[model samples]
Target: MFGDMMGMMSKLKEAQAKVEETKKRLDTVLVDEKSSDDLLKITLTANRTIKSIDIDDELLQDKEQLEDYLILTLNKALEKATNINEAELAAAAKDGMPNIPGMNF
Candidate 1:
């Protein structure tokens, strides 16, 4: 039983390492989202770090409209990044997890 526990601990450690690595890798994975009218564009990493925001000249003419567009586009981009980050991290963790008795993942 102790041996099994030790092995399980090792597997957990490895899984944690893999998760960290995946997070680092996700920093390079970019997600792009734009407004419906293409007046605003957002680029972010899978880690949910904003890389850039592109706004059209027309958007600059209307402050309120620009704010609304930025909000919508940034929300969409963040959602996409969150999905990607979750999926990749889950995959990394699941792949490294050790199979133990009576524990259903």
Candidate 2:
């Protein structure tokens, strides 16, 4: 019985380590997306932090359009980041975790 308990404890530790590693790997993934005919671009980290922005000279000629394109590109980058993060976490969990309670997607 003691040996069985030790074995289970070891397995739990391994699973926890895997989870932490997956989180680290996810953080390394960066996503970039463009909009407004490639005049607007947004970069984001896997943790959903916006890293940088690029706007074309022509877009700045019209403040209204620039604002709109900025908003659109940021939104698109965020959306893409969300999708990537979810897919990565889901894939990682599927391989080992198998959907534990309270660990949302």
Candidate 3:
């Protein structure tokens, strides 16, 4: 019984290490997205934190157009970031799963 407990603890430690490594990798992931017309662009981290935004000078003259472009571009960037995050998490979980025959994570 004690040996089984020790093996479980070892697996837990490995999973924790993999999670930390994945978090570090996520911090370095950058995603850039642009609007359909290429009038607006945004950059964000996999953690969904915006790094920068760019807008075309022509759009500055129209507040409504600029707002619309910003919203659309930002949403695209955020969605990409969210997808990346989800994929990374799933990969980490798969890597951390205990090795057992006839079992799936």
What is the TM-score of each predicted model, taking all chains together? 0.96, 0.71, 0.87
What are the runs in model 2 whose C-alpha is more than 4 Å off? Answer: 1-13, 98-105
Clashes of 2: 0
lDDT of 2 by residue, 15-80 (tens): 667767877886778899898489988888876888888888999899999999988888888888
Query: What's every prediction's RMSD, in angstroms?
Result: 0.8, 4.0, 1.9
lDDT of 3 by residue, 41-89 (tens): 8988998888888888989999999998888888888899999998998
> If both were scored by lDDT, which would come out higher, candidate 1 or candidate 2?
1
The TM-score of candidate 2 is 0.71
Best by lDDT: 1
Q: Where does the lowest 10-residue lDDT sum fall in candidate 3?
A: 93-102
For candidate 2, the lDDT comes to 0.77
Alpha-carbon lDDT, every model: 0.95, 0.77, 0.86
Of the two candidates 1 and 2, the one with more favorable TM-score, higher being better, is 1
Model 1 Cα RMSD, 1 decimal:
0.8
Task: Name model 3 segments beyond 4 Å from true.
Answer: 99-103
lDDT tens per residue, model 1, 18-43: 99999999999999999999989999
